[model samples]
Target: MLQRKTTKLINKHLLMSLVVVAFASTSLELAYAQKNQTATKKKSSDISLTSDDKIFLELREASKNNEASKAKDLGQKLSNYDIADYVAYFQIKPRLFDKGGAPRAETMADDAVDQFLKKYDGTALADRLRNDWLLVLGKRKDWPTFDREYAQFVLDDDTQVKCYALQSRLTKGESVNVLAAEVKNILLDSRYFGDACPDLVNSIYKANGFSKHEVATFSRMAVENNFETLANRFDVPDPMADIVRSARKSPEVAFRDFDKKAWRTSKENTAAAWGSVGQYLAKKLDPNGLKAFKMQHELGHHHLLTPETQEWKVRAALREGDWRIVKETIDHMTPSVRKRDPAWTYWHARAQKELGDESLAKESLQALSDQYHFYGQLAREDLGMKIHVPKRVAADESLVKQASSNKAFARAVRFYDMGLRFEGNREWNWELRNLSDKQLIAVAEHAKRIGLYDRAVNTADRTKLEHDFSLRYPTPFKESLAPIAGSIGLDTNWAYGLIRQESRFIMNARSHVGASGLMQVMPATAKYVAKKIGMNSFKPSQLDDMKVNLTLGSNYLNMVLQDLDGSWALASAAYNAGPGRPKMWREKLPRVVEGAIFAETIPFNETRGYVKNVLANASYYTAMSSNKTPSLKQNLGTVSPKASVLSELP
Candidate 1:
């Protein structure tokens, strides 16, 4: 019995030992597997591969194949992934809920709302989404959320006028008050939005209940729009008076009507009757004569009209030294009329001097300084003699005094006034190169107040020492830029450097191609950026505001930086051209170094030159200012893949 019991115990112990060993081996295998899995996950995360990552990959593939349906599906998936992923959300939402097909009203509404909430920071993108939402929702008043959003929407000038007009009709309210205010605003702010006045004026007229002033305003606008029938309704003095006045001031008129015989024959007829003169001139003048006449018109002199013969008659007075005729002409001339003629520069100076008004004479001479080349260089030389260029004032003592003194605002204004005067005289360019840092700051501050942000930025940039270009780089904003810069992982120096180069820091700077604000951002670009930032109701005007411009600009810079594989140099280059071009450039030059070779080889002269200037400016700024400059070469790595795609052709 004892032997049998011992045998059973031995068997049990062996079985138990085997079980323990098996368990240990299994545990070790599980641990190893988990470790490998974690490592794999870390690798994938490092490469930005999440479950939703395939959506982007698929979308790209779909785009490559031009597979709209697949792209739309993937886009929807990406958009629905997370609200915080603005880029993906904006990218996918539009495709998912396209406007062309039977509109997925609910989907579009949600997408727009998502876009708005994400980019609520007042970006151009946000405004676009909001506009989109309003457009899609139409007159549907049931959606309280849409109504609420609309109520808070920051309507642009055109939209505001339209909204007011619509509200007046919907609510049975008088639009005259709103129309009047808008008309006045339009007139005052005409330069802000050029050539869009007719549409706005028409919208105002269409609104309910028009007043006499509104009628008159509409009549004038009608004439401007070439709707002569509507324009002739209001029996105001010949509706063509303003046009005649405009034509009279135009230089082309003078050249066309140069024939004294034609003028003597047509003197009795109305000004509009002189349209024949333009036709005659067009027939008679050669291309060069026509070109010269057009150039003169652009120069803002109008010597064409029969009614203005008296003004020209005064020119003869000056030529013949007939002071009595000059005095008589001056007496009869309106200030507006007096201001138009370049001969006034000479006449005004002579008259002021003869009248023994030394101060007035000096003022006239200063005004005529710019006209020196057109009239004669004598006036400018005389003015230069009297007004010695102001010495460069030290910023340390003078700045503090100017900043604190009651005259601080006044002094800054005076500096700007002088700057303008210099600009008018074409002297600012030379004077700017010699300005003290203190003077530049003062001028910049003054420009900010007067809405000349671009000039201020330029002045600051020009005054900055080439070496210390980055130091204390002036921004239009007083605060909040650092946080924005941080959010986008951008070097403030680089940002400031770009701002300086792009617009010379001008808030209202616009390019001939329709870019606006300090960054010279295109409207379409601003719209995209605004939507990306989720600013639901951004107006284009807000771009002029420093904070908005910087925030959007920084975000855009960040996007470009990422797209260019973290190369600041390439990013800067891409910023000038689009990312696709840079990507192509990098692909084509895969063996080259980023900064030295690829950047140097960029095809677009404008972009290549721009990149070099920006980089140099940034380096200088970083050195002078406290900011650290990142290495252009270090940040952007060596070229990698020889992309089969086309080289980024700038």
Candidate 2:
């Protein structure tokens, strides 16, 4: 956006440079933490920040660490900045955050919050601050004030806040039964057991809104999420609580106890406790869990299994090659849950075929073949058809100019330049809420033109009726990356596919777990790759270099691919979840399993999604890179139990 004769591109980085540096400096974890666009007249992605920009970043850091004194000092220094509200909000937020990291409403002692709310009214920052205040009020049971302000809370998207809203309703004498139903639906997220949610659940149980079975099932779910404290507080009555205790101590012991007469007193409660054990063991890829689940079915207790329990049973069945159980589990799922994943349909068909219902199996797969995704690709291959990419579709060029004039797009570009990805993404998404398919294409095209490679792909991907594969699977640094990939005897397009998924083509992207650069390579992995490739001058800092990241990433990827016998599904899983897991997961396979089945059953939720997406992206990249149609089944190939090779790799 700076005045210049030449235009430039603006792409967003994963995290701020300070966070990336801090993460890279201490990259020691073995597990992966699971978990942009373009524009303009235009702006450089690496645009230099003024002194005010430096102050903004420092204020953000101070806010994060709750350094109120430092943030206040810095906030005062940026009074004249165009977005001084940003600095002031940072100054005020630190005071609100408690030592446990939750904000308390009691911290708002003066008119600081009131003045800021009035000045920045209608802005996203104001809405965000209001949300924070609501959390604090809800925690304190300030229902009158909480109810009044909650109505004005713009993005009522926080689960805890929503739970608090329900709690407020109960305090205001709302019907406990209705509030309980809402609580059950909204409080499923177990990432954290924050204050309001536990209170709400306890109040619901105290009011007898939940039946005995519901209490046992809900308590079982709490234990599954490793919230033993909450489970105990639920006081799941005698025998079942004893079963839960046994199951939590050790899944192996729980499997043995399933045969005990006492554990079988109530079919529903026993199924709940037993299902909890099966779910936990399934995550660990233990086949014995499926054995315990089969006992549930024999005792006619399977009907009591919760949705989460039933879902994990499917994963356990596939790993153990129990085709009958796979078919039975899917058959028991509600129509809504069964249809939620195409994998269920695909596997249900496969299981039916194995169980002597070939015609019905073929009919089911034929239904799944037309869609475009990992399972759809496998279904097509099964039906004797090659997976074909849709013909490229484009929007008109004039829309680019229209997009360039849009205020949200301009600020998004600026925000990306300053490495404020959170703000940039918010601005970009706000404008995309109602864009038509072709308009989305237009925005994507403009984003691609200005070097917003990440946003171009993401925006183009949103279109249901039109698409530009070149924009969606762009090779931003292909000139350097392609040769590195090829030199290592790896597929360049697959590298592009992986990079596209890893960082959305950001050059200096760094994940929270210290996976850095274009490919999001972890520092330890980068160091190991460096040693393997004999790159004597390598330092972890060099991972941010375009060439270095691609080199190490491709090399590491090649090693996994080679060891896994070129199974893209396995390699992709290895890349995301470390080599040891897929190797162990693969070794547990009873026989040669379909690639789609292998991916669908990956125990780690993030790794499962990661493998499916990377292979799907590669399939499209293959079509774009060469005129020939691509086959994802070929990439996912067959996942078989193989012998040693990469067993020694980290």
Candidate 3:
């Protein structure tokens, strides 16, 4: 099973059956929209609709077509059209902006939106409207209004709004130095920058919020990360811009031409350039990545690189088995970058230990060992301790009752019923933001009761003081899966671990790449495995079948495991990154390295994380299932060349 990000929803008829809670008689408008959902569904032609249903459906179409007059006329025909807020929203949206994103002077959207916000304050749609209105205000440079609304922007998740928030600060005559650090963090990822973000960066640079060298590094970092729009808007020299372009289009050529063209600019900053090219090369798996990084190391500018490039340098050095370089590169990283993820903290400690700094290593490992994740378990092993589960905290009946009646949880269920998972998860997480450990466990229990296993596992996982491994690592299809795994000489715990990560036991889950079911197997991979197991008349569509999907998924996993000399870490990586990739990585190994080190140096971020999580998840499952000490170090074993490569495993 590879990556599957898309959620597969069942029939919409199921949605019609879901009981949406009515907002306590306070929302007479939305109540009308939901109250009739309990009625039996009939064919459109066979149905004799009520006057309200007819008016509401027409209002919906009118609003969709932006027939403002027709929608208003329809709205006037009914006092209770359930979801009246939506009708109001549709009417105001067209008025706020016509076909383009401009409000005509004749439109009265401003007053209408104010009324909607007042009526629906604290609701999800109200927050959404505020977000939309803030964008319009941002475009109009209405700083006072933007500032007021931005304060109530519950999510504040939009990059453009974030950019506008900064711009509003500047408009209020805030000191550039005061906002410089925030600006830098915002501009870190240019791809999320959107239209307003580039201008924000430009404004900061032009206002001297950032120095020339700092601007250069940020701009080049953006370009190297496949975002050229920021660099184009940046006021850099033509030569520097050209260098970013070359590096983007062709890293090898740019790396070669960089030295010759260094004097073209002020020659004050080559760190961004070298770092940019090296990152591009490193991503391509080219040997010149190390060569270019060595140049940055020689110039003493490694620390001047972007955080991503700094991480790549560390990964590149680790892959090369150069402990000194790994230590040095990690040392050059900023403190924030070094401490952001436990993986880095763990790797830094390992690097130091490799260089005979046990005192430094022990401190980092000791801090990291308290966690129970992949890196945490590895850290525990490094400190010579076995993996152990934290004591379980039992949920109470009172907490369960509170969770069952939770208004936010009810709304989340409604959204999930409508297959709007983004909105549902946002609502679910918002409620979780302030909940106590006890409340979280109760919420998870309630979620599990309603067949929301993904939410159940995720919520249970957030508990810090008390642990519940059964809730965290739920076994949805254990009855069917255990024997299937055993028949193929597979550890049922490993299957559960991989399945937990893949689809969270959602029977109908589908990924962005078309992988499906609990196994998250690709359609093509499903067919290949089907044929290998002599499955006649197997269609890709049948991947949704529980029994068939498990059979194929387990077989594929065992195939990779055998090919990888039974190394769980290697097989897990192969499963995620393809069996051939792990082989290639192993073949490049100067000598056999520790499994954890090999995993740490994995080039693909997603696959690297996948391997760690899958194996760690497997270890946890083992600890819960058997009377055994689940050791991540033992699970990982030693990473080495495959005993016998399966060229056709893919």
Which number leads on TM-score? 3
lDDT (Cα atoms) of all candidates against the true structure: 0.44, 0.72, 0.71
| Pick by TM-score: 2 or 3, better one | 3
Give lDDT: candidate 2, residue 448.
85
Better model by lDDT: candidate 1 vs candidate 3: 3
lDDT of 2 by residue, 1-650 (tens): 10001111111321111111111100111111111111121123456989888888888889878888899899899889877777788888888876567766674533787788889787777888887777877877888878887898876878788988988888778899998767655655455446667667777888888766766665666666667666666635324666656666777777776666635377676666667778767766677788777766665555456567788888888877889999998988655467666778988988998899989988998898866666777778778887767677776778778997898899888888887776676678657768987788899888988888767877776776666667767878878987898788899878877777676776766544456677777676677778989998899889878899889889988988887788888888777766666777888777888787789888866567667778877887887788778888777778888764534444
Clash tally, candidates in order: 24, 2, 3
Model 2's alpha-carbon lDDT is 0.72
Per-residue lDDT over 158-183 for candidate 1, one digit per residue giving the tens place of the 0 to 100 score? 33333433433434444555654545
Ranking the candidates on lDDT from highest down gives 2, 3, 1
TM-score of each: 0.33, 0.82, 0.83
lDDT of model 2 at position 350: 84
Top-down TM-score ranking: 3, 2, 1
